[model samples]
Target: MFVKSEYQKKLVHVKDVLSMINSGDHVVSGLAGAEPKAILSELHTAADSLRDVSIITCLPMGNYEFFGNPQYKDSFLMEGWFYSGFMRKLHANKNITFIPNHLHFASTKRLDYKVPRIYMGNCSPVDAHGYVSLGLSAVYEKDMIEKADLVILEVNPNVPRTFGDTLLHYSKVDYFVEADYQMPELPVTEPNEKDKLIGKHIAELIEDGSTIQLGIGGIPNAVAQALKTKKNLGIHTEMFTDGMVDLVECGAVNNSMKTIHPEKMIAAFALGSKKLYDFINDNPSVEIKKGTYVNDPYVIGQNHKMVSINTSIEVDLTGQCCSESIGVRQISGTGGQADTAIGAQLSEDGKSFIALYSTAMIKDKTTGEIIEKSKIVPMLTPGAIVSLSRNDVDYVVTEYGAVSLRGTSVRERVKRLISIAHPKFREELQKEADALMIW
Candidate 1:
């Protein structure tokens, strides 16, 4: 009986792996922090020989040559589920496309429509049992790998070995490429005075032992900082970050009262600095699961006192939130905002909060002058996409105050939202509301 080790059999050069990728094959890369840089770079280098190859990804962190140069457009096309700053710039290209989806069903919907031919991602070194962990991100990688015909892994020692639904046996992977690239870091946001005020208002609404779901950015970081004094807070978020790590260290989040996955920080993915990676590496306190379960409204609602804190770019008086876009321009995708907002509201004692600055400084298109305008408007800009409908909003918080919109009439919502607007814009907003006959 001759049985060779799978690792030796699967180990191949980057060019060799690229040679396996046929033209017109659908390729799905890993999500966020788990993206396979080496393999992707090789794919870009070999792009001249391929044609109509589609590269599908979500929130890709680094600036890769493949996406940086537009010359490969004839051979490759890029599709994003959620746009990063780099991807947003690439939107000028006609070949790039965006897929609108809720976070929970992102993988399932794509799979149902078209199963990918190749799945490439980064993973931790093989463990004693020949199992590799999908480190940092498990969002849709698990589902994509299962559906793809060929699975390729970039073995990176720097990637943390996380537990839960991300482990895979060596036999499952068709090829391997060793890589030693530095993991991308998401810096900690310093909360300004306005952010601090908003954080304080949001923190007041959260009681001790509440299960919280927080997205990334300055506002969520501010909220987490505000909750430092609370006790027994549990984390059930879609993306865990450095702020959550701080909460856990401060003894504010003990995960003691969660109805689901009690005593464990439950998340589908993580993106942050090296410290966050070190914290979750082989740490039994953290459990990274699949996005299908982590972001499911039904699953999130099962937790007691679930409080979801998210941010919005602009909000209308009627409670419609434009979080994913600026007017008709797509700044980002609708990533778990609707899911967590509605799910937290579905809980027995849950509350969902949409927080943003009361006003924004925008440059006048005609005059090229920067002007301060109200973000709480009478109506959303024409062509704006509503990430969260009026019916799903529970609490709307600004630096001025926080107002509950749940079960409120249109007139009542207008008044409540107006009270929290920037003092300078209150009068103008009132006049607009009057003209619209909303109050």
Candidate 2:
């Protein structure tokens, strides 16, 4: 419709684009569903011709061989901001390592370390006026594309065209590789009985007209179901999932009472079911923004009665939460756990919640027996990294009950947290706390 012929000159096959890659280049792939599968899937075919190429990825949807297979270690090294199962399983291969960052500063921090040589992502077909939508994610893709030596995008008709900062002029992108594929989808995670109990407790804490941020998991979905009866809720989050779609369809999230961006849902990126993609297609009510602004504490604090809900792997008596690790083993990334928690606290009358199960089942290494271990402990596992510090924790919920620790003293926090732990481990935790003289 607008300058179509002018942009068509830049079209190229995926193999031709791969020829531009050279040794010692820094390649950045799109986030989540925005990943350019056609280009990435064939990257390894050219790997034998290159050497020492570094790649930066965030929440990759598919496991491309460049980083997934240890055999390609000599030619490519993966530096990820966040990891999926494929990357985590190959972490010990020595070709992949985590690049620690907060969601808001992921792009900025990386550029400070090394500028990108190439930026690749998925986008909707060019529209009238010579513009293309970045589609599913804006998280940090836009930031990388801005300064990369080359910009190549997979033009997929199946990608949902979204609004806000997801648009880019055709002239800015170097090449367009035609693609025909369905966008990746994640099915809804059904909540278990324990998830429902924790969800109900959290639902009771939220007031009407409140805005909320939800992380990925059954607990968040349960929270979504629990909030179905609420009126005029709003969404301002890092990752928008299908649960939010359910809330909107149910009329619970009208966004009418938001203090900022009223009547619209704001997010950095989205991931979930095919239904979720269709709901956001050309939807003016949904805005896909950059992670720098969406996850910023000051920006997130502008919402009315903001509520941040997230999950954890384990929590200690003093309110420290190890969410992304098991001892020294990395499971995920810090993501926006601290960002949203602090931002919600900054909002007037806003609240942040951390939820988890009371206990976990573990096999005893020495006796070969299965036992129930408390997720609530006097101290974190020896090498566990603290995802959320004690100062930022607000409310914590478990199947047994919920506890609030805002402005609470150390001794009081110990008591409150232990009270909500599984009954079988309460006394054991108390003795550990006393022996350490931590409270």
Residue pairs whose backbone atoms clash in candidate 1: none
Identify the runs in model 1 with alpha carbons over 4 angstroms from their true place. 1-4
Where is model 2 more than 4 Å wrong at Cα?
A: none
Which digits, one per residue and each the tens of the lDDT, describe model 1 over residues 1-439?
1124768788888888899989998999999889998887767888778899999999988667676778888788888899888888777766577899999999999999999999999999888778889998888999999999999999999999999988888888989888899888988888898999999999999999999999878888899999999999999999998999999999999999999998899999999999999999999889899999999999999999999999999999999999988888887899999999999998989999999999999999999999999999999989999999998999999999999999999999999999999999999999999998876
Model 1 alpha-carbon miss at residue 116, Å? 0.4
State the lDDT at 63 in candidate 1: 64
TM-score of each: 0.98, 0.98
Q: What is the Cα-based lDDT of residue 178 in candidate 1? A: 88
Give candidate 1's error at residue 195 in angstroms. 0.5
Among these predictions, the greatest TM-score belongs to 2
Please give the CA lDDT of all the candidate structures.
Answer: 0.91, 0.92
How far residue 135's Cα lies from its native spot in candidate 1, in Å, is 0.5
Error of 2 at 9 (Å): 1.6
